[model samples]
Target: MGAEAILEKIRKNAEEEAAALAKQGEEKAEAAAGKIRADAEAEAAAILGNARQRAEELEKRERLMAGLQIRKNTLAARRAVMDEAFSLAGEQLADLPKERWEALITRLLLEAAETGAEIMEVPAADREKYEWTPEGNLPIIGEKSFFKRLNAALKESGREGKLTLADAPANVTGGFRLMGPVYDVDASFDALLSQAREDWEQEIYRILYPKDE
Candidate 1:
């Protein structure tokens, strides 16, 4: 329910507890002898004071809890928005047009290439999409072929066009990974987005929540 409703419920409960304490004090004061009644009256006053203090504490505690709940909810909502922002970015990457997608992937592949002879491992679906023929062989020399573009990029980058495709597909999408002799460079969409998230999270948050609200 709403915070107001919760607060109102807590208010009623505290008031009821205070009323019960006041009634008990009244009963003790009424059943005492004259002198004893004076002592009982004083004790009753102390009891009422305690009840007021306890009620105030209960209100404070409830308010604190309500405040915490609100903060938790706000943070959860903000996180949801942040997650959606990243998800949309990934979706945009996935939905890139063929030529555009190839160009983007080619750029990443070129940048990630160290020796230019690394095995390019892409997902099986990507292999079919790029028409990667038997054992890393390019189907034909054409601008449409992604493999030929890789060789062109490698040559342009002052490296041998010895880059070959892995026989087995990589568990990746939107990009490929370079398996070098000593290391590997992941250029998959997941990896790219993950890194981008880490690097640009604060910047994106600033744009999303201008006041940091």
Candidate 2:
């Protein structure tokens, strides 16, 4: 072959080899870039999904806390109202009329004195109003009295009854305490009201805190 022809053929072979290498490199780079982009898009979608789930969870937790706070506040308010009502009722009961007070005491005494053998203990504040005689009879005004009422109640229950007032006054608010040989019965207004409140707490709560419309 001639020298110029050999040199031209060598140049043409070199150029073709270089072009083929460049095309292969470009194809590899494009494939790598496409894979990288796809991975990045998938990561972004996962991150967005996680963020949404966390946001929903946080919202639900906040709602639950808010509901609990509301319920706590409502219960506190209801308790306050019931306490105030009971305090007001106590004041009214303490300030009851003399006639009503006497009637209540009489009824309590009648209920308490079952056998009439028990001693009826009265408060110092009530010593002047209700006086007991030595014969175990208490005079109301002149003839009609608590002894007759107690006797009538006991006889109706088919039991002989006898009641005498205690010389020592009780420390109580309005009601009396009946002392038998074995056990003593507390019929005081404070004690009675406390028991009543315990028994009727649910009913009282319902009345105080009705469901909202």
Which candidate tops TM-score? 1
Q: Which stretches of candidate 2 lie over 4 Å from their true place?
A: 1-28, 132-158, 167-169, 209-213
Give each model a TM-score: 0.70, 0.67
Which regions in candidate 1 have their CA more than 4 angstroms from the true location?
A: 1-42, 132-144
> Which residue pairs in model 1 clash with each other?
none
User: Candidate 2, residues 27-49: lDDT per residue as tens digits?
Assistant: 99999999999999999999999
Encode model 1's per-residue lDDT on 1-213: one tens digit a residue. Answer: 999999999999999999999998887767656668788899999999999999999999999999999999988998899889888988998899877888898889878988888888888877765655435466543454668668878988898878887889998766888899888998999999999989998888788889866
Per-model lDDT: 0.84, 0.76
Q: Which prediction has the highest lDDT against the true structure?
A: 1
